[model samples]
Target: MTVLKNCRLLPSLTEGYDQPTGDIIIEGKHIQRICPPGTAPTDSGTTIDVKGATVLPGFFDLHAHLMFANQDYNASVLRSQNEYMLDSMEYARVYLKHGYTTIRDCGNDFYVGVSIKNAIERGIIQGARIITSGKIISPIAKGNKSFGTLYEEVDRPEDMMRVCRNEVVHGVDFIKYMITGAVLNESGEPGEMVTTPAEIQAIVEAADSLHTYVAAHCHGTEGIKQAIIHGVRTIEHASYLDDECIELLVKHGCRSSLVPTLSIAFSLFNHFFEGTILPEFMEKAKDACEHVIEGMKMADAAGITIGWGTDFDRENFEKYVGLEFTSRAKTGLPNEAILRQATINSAKIVGLEEKLGTVKCGKYADLAVVDGKPDEDLTVMKKLPLYVLKEGVLVAGTALQQEKSYE
Candidate 1:
C-alpha cells in the first residue's frame, strides 16, 4: 500500500476543487480511498508527504503518431523500421516525464506501435500507457504511396473491411482512416476530399464488428460531415468544420468527438511565417491555422466535446504538448475547461473514462503533482511534473524510498 498525504485535489465533475485537504490511499494499482487529511487510517505502509502540492489526474493525448521523429514527411518514409521503433521508446519516456500518463497513437508504420505497447506492458520499458492504431487505411493514390509504410492503401470500398480486419488481426486498439489529405502531403491538398462516405461506413462497420472504433483523419468540411454521418468515433484535425458540420456533430449526439490538433497548425505557422519552413507547406499551415480556430470556437459554442492533441513528433514532443492549452484559451475556453480537455475529455475520447480520467476513488492511481496551482496559472505545466505516479508506483520525480518499519 502507498499513502499520498496532504495534497490539493483538482476539481472534477463529482468533487469540487476547493472541497478540502485530503489523502489518497492506493492498494495495488487502484485508488483505495480518499478522505480529509489526517483522517486516513494510520497503518504500516509507504507514505509520501506531498507537502500540499496541487494534484491532477494524469494528462492524455488522444491523437498522436509515435513513430514520426521530426516534421519532414519524406524523411520519415526513408527511415528504417528498426530505427523508428528505437526512437519511439525514448519518445515515450519524454511524454511520461512531462505528465502524460496515457496516449493513443493515431498511426504508425511497420506495427511498431503494437511492439512498443507490448514491451511496456511486460515491464521491459518504462513509458506512458499506449493505445495504438497499427497503421492508417487510405485510398490508393500517388500521394498516399509517397508516405511509404505509414499508410495501407486500398482502392475499393470493399477493401476497407479487409484492411480494417487485418489491422485488428495485428492487435490494434482502433482503426484510422484517411477521409481527407494531410497538411504535409505536398502532392495532395488538405481541403480535397479523398475517401467517400461509403468507404468510411465500411471501415466503421468493420471496426464495430471487432468491438472497436474508427478515428478519421479529416480536414475538409465535406469529409468532416461524411465522417460524422458514418459514425466515426473521433474526427482528428477538423480544421475546416463549418456550421453544417457542427450541427451534424451535435445532432449525432457528439459521439464522434473532435480532437483539434491546433498545436501542429500554430507550430507550422510560426515556422512558415518566419520563412523557416518551405513555402508550399507554409501556405497550407496558414490556411489550417486560420480555419481551425474558427471551427474550435463554433464547436465549443455548440457544446461539442473537444479533446487535446499535439500531433507532434519525438523531436518536438516536450516543446509543444502544453501549447495546446494556450491554443484553446485563444478560442475563449477558460483555464479549467482547457485542463479538463487534456484529462477527462481525452479519457472519454480514448474510451477509458471510467478507469483513468479523474483522481477519484476506485480509478487507476495515475496522477501528476505540480508545484503551482494550474487553475490560476495555466503555464505552470510547461515545467515538468514535480512528481508522477503511474499505477500507484513512482515513475518519475522525487519520492522517498521505502524504509523498513520497526516498532
Candidate 2:
C-alpha cells in the first residue's frame, strides 16, 4: 500500500473531499482509501507527503496522433515491428510527463499503438494507459500516401471495411474513420467528404459487433451527421457544424473532441510569407479558426459536451497545460467546468469513465499533483505538476527550483 499524505483531494469539478487534509491510500493499482491526514492505513508500505498540493485524477487526451509526426520525416518511423517497440517507449513517457495517464492514440504508424499497449500491459513501458485506434482508415486518394501525401486515403466501402475490421481483429481498442477531408489538404479547401454514410455504417456495424466505439474525423457538417447517425461515439473536429448538426449530435448523445488545432493555424500564419505554405493553406487555416471559434461558442451555448484537445506538439507543442486549458476557460465559462471537460468529460469520450477521470475509491491510482489551487486560477494548470503518479507509481518528483515548461 502507498499513502499520498496531506493532499487536497479534488475528486472532480463538482465533487471533492470535504475534509481539508487527507491521505490517498493506494493498494496495488487502485485507490483503496481516502483518509484524513496523519491517519495512514495500517497496510501502507510507502508514504509521500504531497505538501498540500492539489491531487486530482490524471488528465486524458481524447484525441492524439501517435505517428503523424513521423510522416514529416522517416528518421523516427516506427512502422517496423522493432522500431515500433522502441519508439512507443519514448512516446508513452512524454505523455505521462504531461500528467496524461490515459490517452487515445487516434492513429499511428505500423500499428505502434497495438504494440505499445501490449508492452505496457506486459510491464515493458512506464507510461499512460493507452486506447489506440490503429492506422486511420481514410478514402482512396492522393492524401492517402504516407510520405509524399499528407493524408492516408482508404476509400471504397469494401476496402474501408476490410481495413477497419482488420484493425479490430488486430485488437485495436477503438476504430478511427476519416469521414471528411482534412484542413491541410494541398488544394487549400477542406477535402470533400470521402466515405459515404453507407461506408461509415459498415465500419460502425463492425465496431458495434465487437462492442467497441468509433471516433470519426469530421470537420464538415455532412460528415459529422453521417458519423453521429451511424453511431460514432465522438466527433474529432466539428469545425463546420451547424445548428442542425449540433442538434443531431445532442439528439444522438454524442460528443466532440475539439482539437482547436490553433497551433496549426498559427503555424500557417507564421509561415505565410515563407512561401512554404500555399495560399489555399492560409485560407483553410483562417476558415478553420473562424469556424471553430463560432462552433465552440454555439456548442457551449447549447450545453454540448466539449473536451479540450490541441493537435499541437514539438515546435508549437504548448507544454503549459494551463495555456491549453485557458483557451476553454476564457470561453466565458467557469474554470471548474473547463477542468471537468479536461478530466471527467474527456474520460467519458474515451469510454474510460468507470476506470479513471475522477479520484474515487477503486479507480486506477493515476493522478496529478499541482502547485496551486486550480479553482481560483485555471492558469495554474500551466504550472508543471509537482508530482505525477501513474498506477500508484511515482514517475516524477517536484524540483522546486525548476521552472514549469511547455512541451
Which candidate has the top score in TM-score? Answer: 1
Backbone clashes in model 2 = 10
What TM-score does candidate 2 get on C-alpha atoms? 0.85
TM-score of each: 0.92, 0.85
Candidate 1 structure quality by residue, lDDT tens digits, 39-119: 776676777778788888888888878886777667777877778888888888777887889988998888888999999
lDDT of each: 0.81, 0.68
Best candidate, lDDT: 1
Error of 1 at 112 (Å): 1.0
lDDT tens string, model 2, 53-99? Answer: 88878887777655443323444332555655565567676667667
Could you tell me the TM-score of candidate 1? 0.92
Clashing pairs in 1: none
Clashes, model 1: 0
